[model samples]
Target chain A: MRVLGIDPGLTRCGLGVVDGRPGRAGMVAVGVIRTPSDRDTGERLLYLEDNLTTWVRRFEPDVVAIERVFADVNVASVMTTAHATAIALLVAAKAGVPVAFHTPTEVKAAVTGDGRAGKAQVTQMVTSILKLTEQPRPADAADALALAICHTWRGGTEIRYAAAAARAGGPR
Target chain B: MRVLGIDPGLTRCGLGVVDGRPGRAGMVAVGVIRTPSDRDTGERLLYLEDNLTTWVRRFEPDVVAIERVFADVNVASVMTTAHATAIALLVAAKAGVPVAFHTPTEVKAAVTGDGRAGKAQVTQMVTSILKLTEQPRPADAADALALAICHTWRGGTEIRYAAAAARAGGPR
Candidate 1:
C-alpha cells in the first residue's frame, strides 16, 4: 500500500509518502508545506487546501495518515485546527482514499519505541527508518513521516465513517 | 482603517471585512470559505493558505483580526485547530498586514454586549451592525466578522507596534 502521512500545523505542515508492499517498504516523497506569515488567515488556509489538493492528485496514495488533535484550550485555535483537519479528510474522501488518524503518543511509540518520545527522537527515528542521508528539515516533515509509518503498521484496523462523523460534528 | 476578521477552520472559514474610520463606526463584508470535506488535514491547510492569500490581495485591508484558540482535552483535535490558526497568522504576516487576536468571549461581548451570547445572538448582531439584507451564511463567516469588529474596537486601543511585533514574531 502506498501511504501518505501528514504532521499538521498552521504555519508548517510535514508530509511524507511511503510505498509499503507486503514485505517491502520504500519512500516516495517527504516535504513540508509552509504558509508565509504575512498573509490573511483565510488565505493561509486556502493555501493549505490548494497545495494539499494538488499533492493528493499528483501522488494518489492509497491511504493518508494524520496526527490527531491532542489538547483542548484555545477554543478559537481548536476551531481553526479542526478546520484544517476537516479539509484534509474532505480531500481524502474526494479521492476515494481511506484515512487513518493516530494520536501523537501512538506515533511516538511506533517511531521511537516510546509514547513520550521528544521531537528530536521522532525526527531521528523517521530519518533512520527512511534510511535518509540526513534528517528531515523543520522537524514537522519527519513527524509527518512517522505518522505515515504508524498508519502503515496499523492500516485498516480502525474503521471510520468520516462523512457521517463530520456532518454530526459542529467544529472542524 | 480597514480591519479584516477571520474565523479559521478546516472545512469552512468565516471571513469578515470591516471598514473603520476615525470618529465613524465600521461596516462589515462577511462570507465563508468552503472546502470539500474529503481532503486530508494537510491539503485542507494548503487550501486555506491559497484562498486567504487571494482574499488579502483582493481586499487590501489595513489590519487582520483572528480568534485565539480554545484548548480541549482531545489532543488529536487540538493539534488540527492549532494548525489552522497558525496558518492564518502566517498568511497575515506574509501580507505585511498588522494582525490582532481575540478570544471567543471577547468577540461575543463586543458583538452582543454579552460574553455568553449564543451563536444566533451574535449572528443577529452581526447582521444588524453591518446593515446586511440577510444573515451571513454559515456561522463561521459571521463569527469572523465579529472577530474583526472586536479587533477593530480593541486594536484601536492597542499601541500600533506593527514593525516591532512583526520583527519579534517573524512570519508564522
Candidate 2:
C-alpha cells in the first residue's frame, strides 16, 4: 500500500509518501509545505490546502497517515496546527483515501522500538530504515518520513480503530 | 453595503445576509447549515465547505463577518469551531471578499446597547431591527441575523482594523 504521511502545521507542514508493505517499504517522496507567518492567516491556510491538494493528487496514496496532536503550551499555535490537520483530513476524505492518526509516542515506538525515543533516535532509525546516506534535512522532513515508516509497520492494526472510527463517527 | 454574518459551529453553522447601513439595513436571507454527527470529520468539513461556498456565491455579500471564538471549556468543540471559522475565512480570501470578526460581546452590545444583554433581549432587538414580525426560529437563526445586523451598525469602524488586518496579513 502507498501511504502519505503528514506532520501538519501552519508554517511547516511535513509530507512524505512511502510505497510497499511493512519492513519492505521504499520512500517515494519526503518534503515540507511551509507558509509564511507574515501572510494572512486565511491565505496561509489556503496555501496549505491548495498545495496539499496538489500533493495528494500527484502522489495518489491509498492511505493518509497524520501525526496526532494532544496538547501544547502555545494554544494559538495548536489551534492553527489543529486546523491544518482538519484540512488534511478533509482533503483525504474528499479523495476517498483512508485516513489514520498516530500519536508521537506511537510513531517513535513503531520506528525505534521505544515509545519514549527522542528525536535523535527516531532520526537514526528513519535514515537506516530508508537506507539514506544522510538524515533528512530540517527535522520536519525527517519527521514526515518517520511517520510514513511508522504507519507502514503499525498502521494496519491501528487502522482498525482510528481510521475506521474517523470514517464512521465524523472526527472525534 | 452587504454583509454576510456567520456563527460557526460543527453541528450547526448559522448564516445570514443583510444589505444597507446601520439602522437602515434590511435582512437579505438567513439560515443554518447542519452536519450529521455520524459522518466522518473530513466529510463533515467537506459538507460545510460545499454548502458555505454555495451561500457565499448566492449572497455575494460585500463583507463577511464571523463570530470570534474565545476560550471555551470544551477544547475539542472550540477546535472544531476554529476550523470551521478557518474554512470560512479561507473561502472569503479565495473569493477576494473582505472578512471581519466580531466578538459575542460586541454583537450583543451593537444589537441591544448592552454587552451583558440577555439572549431574549438580543432576540427582541434583532426582531425590531430586522422589522420581522416574529423572531427567527431556533436560537442559531436569530443569532445569525443579529450578527448581520451588528455588522451593519458597528462593522464599519471594526472593519478598518479586522478586515484590513486580515486582507493584508491573514485571518486573525
Candidate 3:
C-alpha cells in the first residue's frame, strides 16, 4: 500500500509518501509546503489547500496518514496546526482516500522501538529503514516519513483485523 | 453592506446573515449547520464545507465574519472548533470575500456595550437591534446574529478607516 504522511503546520507543512506494508517500505517522495508569514491566514490556508490537492492528485496514495495535534502542545501553535490538519483531512476525504491519525509517540515507537526516542534517533532509524542515501533535511520531513512508516506497519494490522471481523459478521 | 457571520463548531455551526450599515441592520438569514457525532471527522468536515459553500453562494455577503477560536476554551472541543474555523476561512477566501475575525468579548461589547455581558443580554440586544418579533432560537443562532450585528457596526468603521488610509496614501 502507498501512504501519504503529513506533518501539518501553517508555516511549514511536511509531506512524505512511502510505498510499503508491514516490515518493508520505500520512500516515494518527501517535501515541505511553506506559506509566508506575511500572507493573511485565509490566503495561507488557500495556498496549503492548493498544494495539498496537487500532492493528492500527483501521488494518488491509497491512504493519507497525518500526525495528530494535541491541545496541550504549545498553546499558540496548536490552533494553527489544527487548522492545517483540517485542510489535509478535507483534501484526503475529497479525494476518497482513507485517512488515519498517528500520535507522535506512536510514530516514534513504531520506527525506533521507543516512544521517548530523540529526534536524531528517529531520523537515523527512518533513513536506515527506508535505505535512504541521506537523512531527510528538515526534522518535519523526517517526522512525516516516520508517520508513513508507522501507519504502514501498524495500520496494516488494523486493516487486516477489521477485514477479518467483517468476514465473521462482527463489528467493524 | 451584507455580512455573513459564522460561529464555527463541528456539531452545530451557527450561520447568520445581515444587511445594513453601522446603526441599522436587518436579518436576512439565520440558522445552523449540524453534523452527526457518529460520522467520521473527515466526513463531518466535508459536510460543513458543503453547507458553508452553499451559504456563501446563496447569501453573497460582502464580508465573512467568523468567531476567533482560542486554545484555552474547553480543551476537548477547541481543536475541533479550530478545524471548523479553518474550513470557514477557506470558503471565504475561495469565494473572494473579505474575512474578519471577532473575539467573543468584541462581539459582546459591540452588541451590548459590555465586553463581559452574559449570553442572555447579548441575545436580547440582538433581538431588539434587528427589530425581530421573536428571538433567534438556539444560543448558537443568536450568537451568530450577534456576530453579524457586531460586524455591521464595528467592521464598518474599520472598513472606512482602511478606505481613508488608502485615499491618504497611508499604510493599510
Candidate 4:
C-alpha cells in the first residue's frame, strides 16, 4: 500500500510518500513547500493547494495520513493550521484517497516509544526507520514521515479489529 | 478591473467578485464554500484551496481584495483567518494579480457611510449597492462584496499618493 503523510503549515508544509507491504516499507518522495513572504494569506494557501495537488497527482498514494491539531490554543493560528490541514484532506478526498488522522503524541509514541518525544528524537527515529543516510530537514518533513509510520502501526490495529469482527459475523 | 474578495472562515468561506471602473461597480459572482462537518480541519482547508483556485482560474480577476482581521477576541480564530487570507493572497500573486486589504470598519464605512454599521445594515447596503434582487444570502458574502467595493474606492488613494510623490521629486 502507498501512503502520503503531511505536516501542514502556512509557510512550510512537509510531505512524504511511502510504500509498504506485508514485511517491507520504503520511502518514495519527501519535500517541503515554502511560501513567499510578500504574498498574503490567500496567496499562500493557493500556493500550498496547487503544489500539494500536483504532488498528490504525481505520487498517487492510496491513502493519506496527516497530523491532527493537538489543542485549541491561539484560535487564529489553529484556524490557519486547520485551513492548511483542510486543504490536505480535501485533495486526498478529491483524488479518491482515504484519509487517516494521527495525533502528534501517537506519532511520537509509535516512532520513538515515547509519547512526549522531542522533535530531534522523532527525526532521528524517522531516519532510522527509513534507513536514510541523513535526517529530513526542517523538522516538519521528519514529523510527516513519523506520522506515516504511526499510521502504518495504527492501521495494523484496525486490521486486527476488522478480522476479529469478521470472525464474529459482525460489521467489518 | 475585476476584483475578487474573500471572507475566510473555518468551515465556510464567502467569495465575491466585482468589476470596478471609477464610476461603475457591479457584482459578478457571490457564493459560499460549504464543507462537510465530518471532515477534519486539514480536509476543510484543502477544499477551500481547491475551490478558490478554480474560482481564480475561471474568473481571471485583475486584482483581489480581502478583509483584514482586527477583533481582539479568539486569537486562534484570527490566526486561522489570517492563514486563509494568506492563501488567497498567494493564489492571486501566482496568477500575477495584485492584492489589496481592507479592515472591517473601512469596508463598512465605504458601503454604509458609517464605520460602525451593524451586520444587518452592511448587508442592506451591499445588496443595494450591487443592485441585487435580494440580500446576499449569506452575511459573509455580503461583507466580502463590501470589501471589494472598498478596494475600488481606496485604490485611487494610492495613485494619488504616487502622483504627489512624483511631483515632489520633480526638479526638487
Candidate 5:
C-alpha cells in the first residue's frame, strides 16, 4: 500500500509518502508544503489547498493519514492549525482519497511504543522503521514520516481494503 | 455594493446577503445552511463548502463578511467552527472577492451600539437597520445579517474599493 501522511500547519505543512505494508514500509518521499507567514490568511489557505491537491495527484496514495489538531489554550495557534487541518481534510475528500486522523498520542504510541514519547525518540523510531540512513530533515518532516509508519502498523491497510471493498460492492 | 455575511457553524451556518452601504443597507437574502450532525465530519464540511460556493456564485456579492471565530473553552466546537470559517474564507478568495471578518463584540457594537448586546438585541437592531418587518427567521440567520450591517458601516465598500484600485495600479 502507498500511504501519504500529513502534519498540518499553515506556514509549514509536512507531507510524507511511504510504500509497502505493515512492518515493511519504506519511505518514498518526505517534504513540507510551506507558505509565507506574511500572506493573508485566505491566500495562505488557498496556497495550501493548491499544493495538497497537487501532492495527492502526484503521489496517488491508497490512503491518507493526518495528525488531528486538538483544542488547546493557545487558541490563536490552534485556530491556524485547525484551519490548515481543515484544508487537508477538504483536499483529501475532493481527491476521492479516504482519510483517517490519528491523535498525537496515538501516533506516538504506534510509532515509539509509548503514548508519551518525546520528539527525539519518535524520530529515532521512524528512522529505524524506515531504515533510513539519516533522519528526515526538520522535525516536522520526520514527524510526518512517523505518522505514515504509525498508520501502517495501526490498521491503515485494513481501512484502505475496507474502503476499496465498499467502493466495489460492500457496505460502507 | 453587495455583501455576503456568514456565521459559520458545522450544523447550522448562517448566510445573509445585503445590498447598499452603511446607513442604507437592505437585505437581499438570508438563510441557514444546515447539515446533519450524524454525517461524517468530512461530509459535513463538504456540504457547507458546496452551499457557500453556490450562494456566492448566485449572489455575486461584492465582498464577503464572516464572523471571526475566537478561541474558547469548547475546543472541539471552536475547531469545527474554525473549519467552517476557513471554508468561507477560502471560497471568497477563490472567487476573487475580498473577505472581511467581524468579531462578535464588533458586530454587536456596530449593530446595537453596545459591544455586550445580547443576541435578541442584536437581532432587533438588525431588523431595525434592515427595515425588515419581522426578525430574520432563526437567531443564527439574524446574527449573519447583523454581520452584514456591521461590515457595511465598518467600511466594507471602502475596503473593496481600495482593493480594486490596488489591483488597477495603486499600492496594495
Candidate 6:
C-alpha cells in the first residue's frame, strides 16, 4: 500500500510519501510547501490548496495520513495549523483517498517505541527504518515521514485484525 | 456594493447577503447550510465548499465577510469552526472577492453601538436595519446579516478614508 503523510502548517507544510506495508516500507518522496507570510490568509490558503492538490494527483497514494493538531498548542499558531489541516483533509477527500490522523505522541511511539521520544531519536529511527543515507532535513519533514510509517504499520495490524475477525464470523 | 457574510460552523453554517452601504442596507438573502453530524469532517468540509461556492457565484458579492474564530472559545467546537472559516476564505480568494474578518464584538458594536450587546439585541437591530417584517430565523442567520452590515458600514469608512488620504497626497 502507498501512503502520503502531511505535517500541516501554513508556512511550512511537510509532505512525505512511502510505499509498502507492515514491517517494511520505502520512502518515495519528502518535501515541504511554503507560503509567504506577507500574503493574505485567503491567498496563502489558496496556495496551500493548489500545492496539496498537485501532490495528491502526482502521488496517487492509497491513503493520506496527517499529524493531528491539538487545540492546547500555542494559541496564535493553532488556528492557522487547523486551517492548513482542513486543506489537507479536503484534498485527500476530493481525491477519494481515505485519511488517518496520528497525534505526535502516537507517531513517536510507533516509530521509536516511546511516546515521549525526542525529535532527534524519531529522526534517527526514521532514517534507519527507511534506510535513508541521510536524515530528512527540517523537523516537519521527518515528522511527516514518521506519520506515514506509523499509519502503514498500524493500518496493517488493523486490516489483519479485521480479517481474523471475519474468519471468526463476527467482531468481538 | 453587495456583501456576503458567513457565520462559519460545521453543522450549521449561516449565510447572509446584503446590498447597499453603511446606514442603508437591504437583506438580499439569509439562510444556513446544514451538514449531517454523522458525516466525516472532510466530507462536511467539501459540502461546505460546494454550498459556499454557489453562494458566491449567485450573489456576485463585492466582498466576503466572515466571523473570526477565537482559540479561547469552547475548544471542542473551535477547531471545526476554524476549518469552516478556512473554506470560506478559500472560496472568496478563488472567486477573486476581497475577504474581511469581523470579530463578534465588532459585529455587535457596528449593529447595536454596544460591543458587548447580547444576541437578542443584535438580532432586533438587524431586523430593524434591514426593515424586515420579522426576525431572521435561526440566530446564525441573524448573526451573519449583522456581519455583512458591519462590513458594509465599516468598509465604507475605510474606503472613504483611503480616498481622503490619497486626496491629501499621501497617508499620514
Worst 10 residues of 1 chain B by lDDT: B20-29
Candidate 5 CA-lDDT value: 0.87
Q: Residue by residue across B120-145, what tens digits does model 1's lDDT show? A: 99999988877788888789988988
The alpha-carbon lDDT assigned to residue B167 of candidate 2 equals 82
Q: What is the clash tally of candidate 1? A: 89
Off by over 4 Å in 6: none
How does model 2 score by TM-score? 0.87
How many Å off is the CA of B114 in candidate 1? Answer: 3.3
Model 4 lDDT per residue over B63-110, tens place: 788887753756556656654665566567667788887888899988
lDDT of 2: 0.84
Candidate 6 per-residue lDDT over residues B31-141, each given as its tens digit = 999987898899889989999999999999999999987888788799999999999999999999999999999999999999999999999999999999999979999
Question: Where is the poorest 10-residue window by lDDT in model 4 chain A?
Answer: A70-79
Name the runs in model 5 displaced over 4 angstroms: A156-172, B156-172
lDDT of 2 by residue, A1-172 (tens): 7889899998899898988666767889988899988988778888888899999999999889998886444677777887798789778878998888899998999889999999998889888898888888677888888888888888655555677788898563
The local lDDT score (0 to 100) that residue A84 gets in candidate 3 is 97
Q: How far is A71's C-alpha from truth in model 4 (Å)?
A: 6.3
lDDT per residue for candidate 5 within A124-156, as digits (tens), equals 999998999998878888888888888887765
lDDT of 4 by residue, A1-172 (tens): 7778999887778888878742346789888988776866656777777898998899998788888784356655665676577567656766778889898889899888999999999999888888899999889888887877778777767887989999999998
Error of 2 at B76 (Å): 1.2
Candidate 2: which docking quality band? acceptable
Those runs of model 2 whose alpha carbons end farther than 4 Å from true positions after fitting are A158-172, B158-172
What's the DockQ of model 5? 0.64
| Residue B77, candidate 4: C-alpha displacement in angstroms | 6.7
Give me the runs in candidate 1 sitting further than 4 Å from their true place: A1-20, A24-66, A72-100, A104-172, B38-47, B73-83, B131-138, B159-172
What's the DockQ for every one of the candidates?
Answer: 0.17, 0.49, 0.81, 0.32, 0.64, 0.88
Best by DockQ: 6
lDDT of each: 0.75, 0.84, 0.93, 0.78, 0.87, 0.93
Better of 2 and 5 by DockQ: 5
Please write out the lDDT profile of model 6 over residues A1-172, one tens digit for every residue.
8999999999899899999789998999999999989999999999999999999999999999999888997987999998999999889879889999999999999999999999999999999999999999798899899999999999989988999999999983
Per-residue lDDT of model 3, residues A1-172, tens digit only: 9999999999889999999989999999999999879988888999999999999999999999999878887987998999999999899989999999999999999999999999999999999999999999799999999999999999889889999999999999
